[model samples]
Target: MAELVLVTGGSGYVAGWCIAELLNRGYDVRTTVRGPGKEESLTQAVSTVADPAGRLTFAVADLLADDGWDAAVKGVDRVLHVASPLGITAGDPAAMIAAARDGTLRVLRAATAAGVKRVVMTSAANTASPSSYATEGTTDETLWTDPDDPTLIPYRRSKTLAERAAWDFMSGHEGPTELTTVLPGAVFGPILSTGTIGSVGIIGRMISGSMPGVPRIGLEIVDVRDIADIHLRAMTAPAAAGERFLATGEFTWMREMAHFLRDGLGPHGHKVSTRQIPDFAVRLTARFRDPSLREITPSLGRRNRHSTDKASRMLGWHPRPAKQTVLNCAQSLIAHGAV
Candidate 1:
């Protein structure tokens, strides 16, 4: 068999698309799930987009430990390190940070040891900018959150630490391995399986009246497919080495998505709402309740836009409009009975 492109966390919500795209693009891929028994969900997800060419394979792996990772990359040609913990629910903050940073380094260490040529890591805009959780305006590659800052969100801090550590290891020292990072912001798009989609949970709450009022924060909502595309391009483009490409769309208001949920799905969909709480009102509500709301206040009335000139000029990468990405996700969610 030909060598496969190894994708960590292949069973993930977003990485699954990248796995399929790799399969479609004629690269045999080996993806890792947390355990051996969990292959069913991963296979079902990849099958949704795979062409039945039998090009995808699964390797059991975990982010918090190093039991089987070294062997997983033994014969792989390249590695797509897309497996990282996301969303803050419950767990040791220090452990999460350790797993993200150490676990990523673990794979790179294995890839380098195995003589793998290139590695594409899935990073986030949060790592690129500290104010990412803030509710307004545009943030790009220029921003980097202070790891020592107490105000940073746990999940965001972990991503920043993990990515910076990886880059430091690969570039700061000479090695046979090369690195490329894809920094995506609030990615949402087509579903590869029948499950809860990315961050669109906030959108559903808005239209269902679950969220009595929309918060004033803004997001640079890029589609998952676009994010997946960026990963693929980074893997093949020789110029992508040692670069962190910001993959995001124009700024979008929180409630504006309700219109997308209602009007955009048009002709065959649900239309729940187009109403919103004013920025001042949200600020007031945020004041009495949570400090997280303070983070939401900055972008209440602005758009966080970015230029794709670099990714475009160099790798021919282009993202569909944010509106279209939202529409596709909304439709996928409804079709899958998630909405």
Candidate 2:
């Protein structure tokens, strides 16, 4: 086999795509799972999108523990740190932040200790989004999310803090290591396997009619395949060192998304609702009718736009537009009989 690459959380929806890209590119993969027994799932996920002859190995590693990560990194040319504690609503912000910040630092420390030359971390647009406050002006990579803002989502806060922790660790590390961060906006696209893609549940719920109206949020989406490609590019592309690449394209709001999906299915897609719910109506109705709407009410009427200018210039990355992302997602759900 050629040089090996270590992928953390290979069984995860996002990481699974990363591993698939690595395997398709003919990299020997040593993936770390929270349990060694989940090797079947990892192998299956990789196999779903990879060639039949791809090579995959697995180890047990927990982000909270220091047990197997060092060994998992041995002889690997690059590390893809995609593991982080992800949750929507949590009882404790400190616990969530620790899992994100400390968990990332732990892996980086292990990578340094194991002499890995390059690391491509899975970051998110949430790290840089200004959704907590009114985004008056155009925002891009230059902006940082206001984590202390009371309106920030717990998951967004976790991602922002974790990415910040990673940058700090990289700055202080004396090792001959390079770190590249791939920050994708709210990701949506087809699943490589029968299993679910984690971040797409909200979209899926909307498609399945479980969500009557979409979140007030807008998504700057790119294909999962495109996001995975940038991770690989970030690993070896010399210019990508110490860079944060935004793997995204144009933005799509709730009504735009519904239209995109509805257009795709022709007859079937017509079932989608394109009515834009007024922010006040949804908010007021939530108190008397539905709590689920209340859960997503905080993000109502927010505009989210991310600039991928740096990505195109530095990594030579080009992402599929958000419209295609929504269309493909709807098509995939229909093909899989989920819609």
For TM-score, the strongest prediction is 2
Clashes of 2: 0
Q: Which RMSD does model 2 reach against the true structure?
A: 2.3
Candidate 1 lDDT over 1-339, as tens digits, reads: 655899998767787888888878888888887877776677777777786357777777788778788878978999999987763224567877888899999898889988898999998877766454443444556677678777676777899999989988887657678999888888888787655265666655554556665665677888888888899899989999888788877677766776776776665434465667787787887798765577556556655465566778778888888788877876777677765
- Where in model 1 is the C-alpha error above 4 Å? 1-3, 87-91, 130-143, 266-271, 279-304
Which 10 successive residues of model 1 have the least lDDT summed? 130-139
lDDT of 2 by residue, 1-339 (tens): 587998888777788888888877878888888875887765765676686354788878887777887888888888999886764225676788778888888889989887888999998877877755455445667777777877776777888888888899999988888899988877778876556567776566666666566546666777877888888988989988888887876777777888777676677665567677778888888888976566577767667577888888888889887887777776776676665
**Candidate 1 clashes between residue pairs 3 or more apart in a chain or in different chains:** 135-217, 135-296, 135-299, 136-298, 136-299, 138-304
TM-score of 2: 0.92
Scored against the true structure, residue 277 in model 2 reaches a CA lDDT of 77
TM-score of 1: 0.89
Q: Rate the local accuracy (lDDT) of all candidates.
A: 0.77, 0.78
Query: Candidate 1 local accuracy as lDDT?
Result: 0.77
State the displacement of the C-alpha of residue 71, model 1, in Å, after optimal TM-score superposition: 1.4
